[model samples]
Target: MINKMQILSLTALGNLDAYIRYANSWPMLSAEEEKLLAERLYYNGDLDAAKTLILSHLRFVIHISRNYSGYGLPQADLIQEGNIGLMKSIRRFNPEVGVRLVSFAVHWIKSEIHEYVLRNWRIVKVATTKSQRKLFFNLRKTKQRLGWFNENELRIVAQELGVCSEDVREMECRMSAQDISFNPFPDDESSDRKLTTVMTHLRDNTSDFANGVEEDNWEMHATNKLTNALRILDKRSRHIIRARWLNENNKITLQEIANGYGISAERVRQLEKNAMKKLRTAIEA
Candidate 1:
């Protein structure tokens, strides 16, 4: 009996508990009534029958969404995703198979929610393989007391989940490791006050000094090679190469060089190519 407008109003104004109660209150259909609706929607392609089926199931999506609230995702978004899954199930549902719509929709609803959790939980996904993904969820339930799992417990969980003990340990480590802010500043620090942030930790004085010395040596070696390569070029070719690549600003075009030397643009390009080849050969030697 609920219209689209009424459903929209209820969704907008009602709290989570109110929605739960409203959905639960929808009368459970008798076998005869369900069969009739399923036949109409499935065989006859009756959209009105489909709409009724979906509205009746909206409450079920809300119920499943409640279970996932512990994941730190917004409840509204989870409900929306679950609703999408419910719709998909409705479209693919086979009423001739004799299963109730609620039973069929459960898998679809949970699949959509699981995908959302994996994608949003961390920037880098913690679970890649099938066993790791299973452990990622199951291991949370297996924990008896917080802290870390003991060796025996780890082995037991590995046996139960049919994964290696090492995988369980790795997943546990990943789960326990919280994301740290890249540039965390002290809470009490004022806007004008300059406090050392995480960036400060990136610099180790000894490593930095060594890196600087190595970089300087690399630049000096590169400069020597470049200077030696330039020496191998004829004057005009060297000038063309420098103008095309080495100049900081106001680089001359091939046409400008050609005009200056009273030569064609193609001739200038050929000279530049020859110069580059000679430089490369000298550098390699």
Candidate 2:
């Protein structure tokens, strides 16, 4: 019993030597046991039955999560997301679907993990349209190697993936592209890579360049002063200032801020007073 209990413990998996041993120790449910548990939860809303179903299939979640390892996301976070999908599947699952829970849960598990990967896999989103998103996941599997696909290969991938060749090429370009710093340092020698960074040289082509420069300079000075002023204030006061003044959308009210921090509105007002005074003084200087 002690050996079995030790085998089930996930702690052993943290060590490379014992990782396979722990994975091998995971429990598998027989066909009868799986059906019984699913039925118990489906009929009685039995929480224990749900727990057993989830625990017994955790290895499946791990397996599905590993398939997405190419996305460069943390393995633990992928597993966590898959667990959420598994729970959602368990909640909505009907035993009458004529498939085992594992079969039904695979879609949900992969769906959740896929969403997580798509969201965090790149600094800027790679895909917005449905077809682009689908290609984003499947295109890598179609390719044979690390290098870019030729025109012929792109056509073949597009056909297999049911997208236009242009789409495969576009997504391929996106995947090949790497995230760059938005504000690259002035000392960087590579101008091409530096230009890839956003907003550092962003200019409104329609706007006057000279006045734009003047306005931009003023804004930068004002922002720096405001930031310095905010630093002098405490954490709560800084948050109150940003929530009240800095935030353009969904600006918070004194009462709302007070409610959040468990203080009276009048106390919040006093803090706002001191913060604004400091800002005005700093900005004037």
Give all candidate RMSDs, comma-separated. Answer: 10.3, 14.0
Model 2 gets an lDDT of 0.78
Candidate 2 has its poorest 10 consecutive residues by lDDT at 1-10
lDDT string for model 1 (152-265, tens) is 888888898888999889999998788777667666655766766676678665667778899999999988999999997889999999999999787989999999999999
- Writing each residue's lDDT as its tens digit, candidate 2 over 37-145 gives 8888889888888877776777788788888888777776777688778888888888877788899999999888878888899889998777777888888776645
Clashes of each: 0, 0
Off by over 4 Å in 2: 1-24, 186-198, 206-285
Clashing pairs in 2: none
Error of 1 at 174 (Å): 1.4
User: What are the lDDT figures for the candidates, one per model?
Assistant: 0.81, 0.78
On the 0 to 100 scale, the lDDT of residue 240 in model 2 is: 94
